[model samples]
Structures are given as structure tokens and as C-alpha cells.
Target: MKKKVAKFSVLPVVGASIFFYSFSTNKAQDINTALLEEFKTVNEELTFEVPYSPDAAVFDPQLRSYPALGKSYVAFKEALGFKESGGDYKVINEFGYMGKYQFGRGTLKLIGIRDTNLFLNSPDLQEAAFYANASRNKWILRKDIERFEDQVVNGIKITESGILAAAHLAGPGNVKKFLRSNGTNSFSDGFGTSIKHYFKKFEGFDTSFVVPDRKAKANSPSVI
Candidate 1:
């Protein structure tokens, strides 16, 4: 089998003692090289940009070659197709969802971003939404720890990655019952597989943020 590689070209623009870079012609190798360069540049300028390099567990063929962030990006793309706009980055969905995350209008509103168009277009808003999603995940993980400490501690035996992932995607309460009713308890069995699969993609990119669907309340629907 012939291995594929990409060539990368990087141009650095320094202003006000800060270095801003433009990466072009990104193929497989090029993109990876640019990432490493960006990593180094950011470290020199800002001290950090993902302190650890991607590993085999997270950088496997299935995860990295396919959808790394899991189903959310797929869902977002589907939503974009539903909107019939050809997935223009500038366009925001009717529900105020935007970017790769597909953030809803209510989420934007809660964060005080009223203009849906602006939120969709602004890089700032996109970054904020991503961070917010990650924050929600942290809260959820905390809650899971509080309630299901034993399940998690025992190598996710009672809980299963599927349950944890479903909880991560849907909500903890829903996943717990889901596990109870089903005879299976593997992370790969349920929504957990998708969540686990996607997390690596999300972690790979800085622009990407997996905010919890705050609307995911006690009895909220799990469709989104």
C-alpha cells in the first residue's frame, strides 16, 4: 500500500510582539506539520496549546480518519443540510445553531448573544460556545462522580462506556435507566460508543468545543 502525505506551507506574521500564522496547502502531512508548527509557535507566544501530543488510543484510523468528534459534527452537518444552505459557515440555523457544534438559539440567548447572525459569523461566539459545551461536560462528569462513584471506580463495569457516553450525550439520569433496562453494558453498545468516538476529534482541534446541552435537564428529550 502506498502511504499518502501532504505538503504544508506556513507564513508567520508578527505584530505587537505576537505571532499570527496562516497555514495553507494542508493535506495529511502538511496539516500535521502545520499543527506541530502552530503548537510550537503558540507555545513560544502563549505558553501552551494542548500540552500533550495525540496518542495511539486517540489517533487510530477509525477515529482520526473518520469523524473524530463523534456524531455531533455529523448531526450538525445533517442540520445544515436540512436548512438547505449548502453548509455555509456564515449561516446560522433557525434554532440559532452554528459552527461545527450546532449550538441552539436558547444557548446563545443564555450567554447574552442576541443577534443570531452575528453569533454565527463571529469566531468569538464559536469559541465561546465550544468552551461552554466542555464546561457542561465537566459539570456532568462531576455529577456522575457524585452519584455513581462506585460504577466509575470499578473500571466502568456496572456503568459501561455506553451508559457513560449516553449520559454524556443525552443525560446521566436517562443513561442510568437505559443501562438497567438493557441486558448490555459496554461503552460500544449504546450512545456511549458515539460519544467516546467523537471526544477524540473534539480534543484534536482547539476551535472545537463540546459544550453540554444545558437544555439537557432532568426530563429533557435526547434527540439533539
Candidate 2:
């Protein structure tokens, strides 16, 4: 059985007020705890497509962390309220997206994620989100490298992993197009620090939440 920790006595060091505002006492704690757990478990199960180590997962130095995702996790936890006895695990928004990853119906279609029931219920959706993010990164990386190659010709320092990470967080196409028009630059102010903080936090997650069998069905109108 998954250990339940309710009634947050401490503000978790992982996020800011906006990142956690929507979560209740119980739900916030659950999300914080589960995030670490899921990271551990997923790394072991999934095969990474590139140079990332399951053993030593680090954010590529150039990318920003997903702040919106951390906030969304908190909000989803509060909305789902998994320990509420009557609540379900699905995170359904008014737009009809479901699961902790908040799979919008449109995103689901674009990503080719079928089985709406499983996507909303199974822990699998979390992995699905990771994969989707990875795919996005791949596209972005290609563009960054081409730009970086030009910089290399100019005798500038460049690294592939750094570009890979940037592409992952900021859409690669956007960054590439930006570089083509603008020029090489670095993250401004505290953006780099914030992302690093969240990357470490996200990497350390473990997801052992006791997914209730009954909750693993198609989303109902209510959180029953």
C-alpha cells in the first residue's frame, strides 16, 4: 500500500506559490512525494532514446525546466484529490484533457495516444508525457545543431547536449528560427537556476501511488 501523508506542515522546497497554490494539504504532499518516486521508476522502465542516463539523469545545461508542468501537477493533485476516498485520479480540465500530464484531446490526437481510459487512469500516461516531450526535443535539437554548426564555423564554443536540453523545453523550431534571425545568447537572469532546481526536483521523483482499481475507468462527469 502507498503511504499517505496528509496535511502539509511545510511548504515544499520544490516550487513557488504559483506552482503549488491550487493543491490542498493532502494533495500537495502526495504530488511532491509521488513526483520523486515516478522519476525513479520510469527511468528504470523506459528506454531513453539518446544520451541521457537512467542512472544519472541530468538536465542538459541549455534548456529551461517545465515550470508550467510543476504547477499543473499541483493543480491536478488538488482537483483529483486522490486521498479523498470518493475522488478519482484523473485530472480533467474544462477543455477535456485528462491525467496528470493533462492530455488535451487535441494533444492526444496529435501524439496518437489512444485508449482514453488507460491514458487517464494508468501510471502509463506519465511515461507517455515524458516520451512526448522527448519527441519534441528531437525535432528541436536538429535545428539547434544546424545553428550551432554555424557558430562553430565562427570559432564559438558549442555542445550538443546543451542544445538538446534547450530544444526540449523551448520548442526547437522556435529557438532555431530565433537564432537564425537573432544570434547566439544565453538564458537571462534566474531562468537557468529555476530550471536546474526543477530539473533536479523532477529527476528525483518516485511514483508509487496506490492507483485504485476502480478509478482506472473512463472519466465520469464527477470525481467519484
lDDT of 2 by residue, 6-76 (tens): 32423453455646664676697899899989998998788666866568677788987655534333433
Weakest ten-residue segment in model 1 by summed lDDT: 4-13
Candidate 2 residues lying further than 4 Å off, grouped into runs, are 1-89, 93-98, 149-172, 183-224
lDDT of 1 at 87: 47
TM-score of 2: 0.31
Worst ten in a row by lDDT for model 2: 206-215
The C-alpha TM-scores of every prediction are 0.33, 0.31
lDDT by residue (tens digit), candidate 1, 1-224: 12322222122223422432223323556879989999998889976566786665555566534345444543433332333335455665564446544556565454445566665666555545444443454455555534553343222333222333344344444444433444243244232334333222222122223334544322111112
lDDT score, candidate 1, position 82: 36
Error of model 1, residue 40, in angstroms = 58
